[model samples]
Target: MTKYRPSKNSDGFTIIELLIVIAVAAVFGALTAGMLANATDIYSDSLERQKFISEVRSSFFKIIREATWQKSYTSFAGSNNKKLNIYSTDGKSIDYEIRNNNDIIQNNDQVSGSNNEILTDKIEYSSSNVYYLDQQGTGIDIVSQIENVRSLKLDFQFSNDTDDLRLQSHTLPYNLRIGRAMSYHE
Candidate 1:
């Protein structure tokens, strides 16, 4: 084997080559930064949406569960029509109300501690969120005639700043349907 020697013209690096490499690296860095920023924004939006949905859904289910065997129900008057009072046969009363124009709160007077809970801060401030329904599913004015109300429909609009979600739920008292038993999902 012959001994190999390096070429005399082979220098370490040229200024132009160094500058070109730096420019390419900078371009790649900038692109990576932009993609990272976009990903962060997407993650933030998704988290917010999930939190909003969780809050609203949990609150809704809590109300449904508590009122499943309600003996009587009433609504607040005037601008608080959306607020409700549910009473059980055991005299336990639970009140659901909107406070500060956005937050949905639950007050269980029967409980001594932890009686008050902030359900969500995404509910739209409106008096029409709760609708009292008759046996025929017709909406009724609770303030005027609440005696005929057999069920309730919750029509809430929740927001996460980036998007808005509307949820409508109609709850029929399961126990009240005595002989007309139906599946849980039905």
Candidate 2:
């Protein structure tokens, strides 16, 4: 009654065990693939969003900088919210407006024919209301006259398929003056 012998089938794993192991491995592999795909999609979307934001910021910076140096502001062609005329110190004028409701056009040399520069194409819809700030920082509409304009406010929006970004800049014009009397010492 003291016999020790190993079974013949113990040399390798059974077919059922092999099948179970393969099925488990396949499930894990599929899960990993799915997660990778999801991460890739998220990364792609994030990149697109970042690019859009960068472009918008760049456009705004250029617009604000130009507006800061504007010596004159006027409405364009009897249109208040649709267009603007900004004059620099060198007597050159530029127009800022939305063309066809989608393009941010900056027309340099408004006295000439069509020198439009596209600032950004992401403008789905935009409208600008230029308010002239008084000495007390009150916003007053400059409908047909532009005098004593201390600052100008430009509010606009940019949009893509799934997102919208709104931006505003209140720029002090370079030609603002208070006309104070200077005291002289004898």
Candidate 3:
């Protein structure tokens, strides 16, 4: 046979074709990485929001319990509209207020042990969701006590740049409503 010569139609990839394939693979890999990073960010944000909501709910219930327990001596503190004062017979008093303009703070000087309790670190105070009663029987802004307030409404809001979670509850010396209803019935 003469010098061997290869056919042009061989069933194999050329250098240009191989290079194109590698480029396409690299593009796909980049896209996948970006997608994964975005997903992780979303998951983290969701988890933070859930934790914030849980804390708000737990704090609301805790305050309700404490307010109920102090029903006998719960009173609207005249000095601070945002604060609800509970005084025991022994002169010890506990003050509950939304401090730092948003976070709930409990000043339990009445307790021989323990200090102020921070109800929650995440509060969207600027949302205008929190409210309290004026001296009258009407609901009003927490920052302002118009008259003889009958109760306080603790409306907590937790939020991130994109989402918001809120919970609300009213505080009335536990027996106030019940006692009033009973008297009316009698």
Candidate 4:
């Protein structure tokens, strides 16, 4: 009987070589997955910041408009200048309030008993300054002196978890911009 020997060159890969290839591929796959996850988180954070700014800007403009246009207010009271009840003769009323100690600001327009409102829970309330006009159109914010005054200014400080913005507003006059000179001349 004679023993046969096999050649050194083989047509297929060795078991050791196949195992190494699979291990390298798995490491690359894991790295790619991690990168993708990080990119997704960055995108989400940017979107949230954008939304926060938009809502803050829009609400600020609306509040300024109300301060300039509305001729009367039913009440103004609260710590750090929060809460305003607008005066309306049309049997409906609108109320603006900052709730929960620097957390949120809300606008509630009540037709009868229900509240129609728009609010954002993300705005961080810092502080607000309320100013009013007397019969002579002087600015005041004292509660004791409110009966003889008109609203003249609204200084609002709004914030998100990431940033802070201060919006200072001044109305034209106590008469609500009625019948004023159109041009200034030398």
Candidate achieving the largest lDDT = 1
- Candidate 4: give its CA RMSD in angstroms: 7.2
Instruction: Give the Cα-based TM-score of candidate 1 against the true structure.
Output: 0.75
Q: Where does candidate 2 stray beyond 4 Å?
A: 1-14, 72-79, 109-114, 124-128, 177-186
Error of 4 at 94 (Å): 1.9
> How well does each candidate superpose onto the true structure, as a TM-score?
0.75, 0.75, 0.60, 0.57
Model 4 TM-score, 2 decimals? 0.57
lDDT of 1 by residue, 1-186 (tens): 999997789658889999999999999999999999999999998897888788778877787677576654332233135677776667677788877569888888778764668878787876337777777989888777765677777777777677777777888755444433245623
Q: Candidate 2: worst 10 consecutive residues by lDDT?
A: 177-186
Candidate 3 vs candidate 4: which has greater TM-score? Answer: 3
Task: Tell me each candidate's RMSD, in Å, in order.
Answer: 6.4, 5.2, 6.1, 7.2
Model 3: worst 10 consecutive residues (lDDT sum): 70-79
Q: How do the candidates rank by lDDT, highest first?
A: 1, 2, 3, 4
| Clashing pairs counted in every model | 0, 0, 4, 0
Candidate 2, after superposition: displacement of residue 11 in Å? 6.5
Q: Candidates' lDDT values, in order?
A: 0.72, 0.70, 0.63, 0.60
lDDT of 4 by residue, 1-186 (tens): 888888698799999999999999999999999999999999998898788788877876666665554433324433125565554434344566666565445444545544535555544455665567665767766476655555466777777777777777766433334432245710
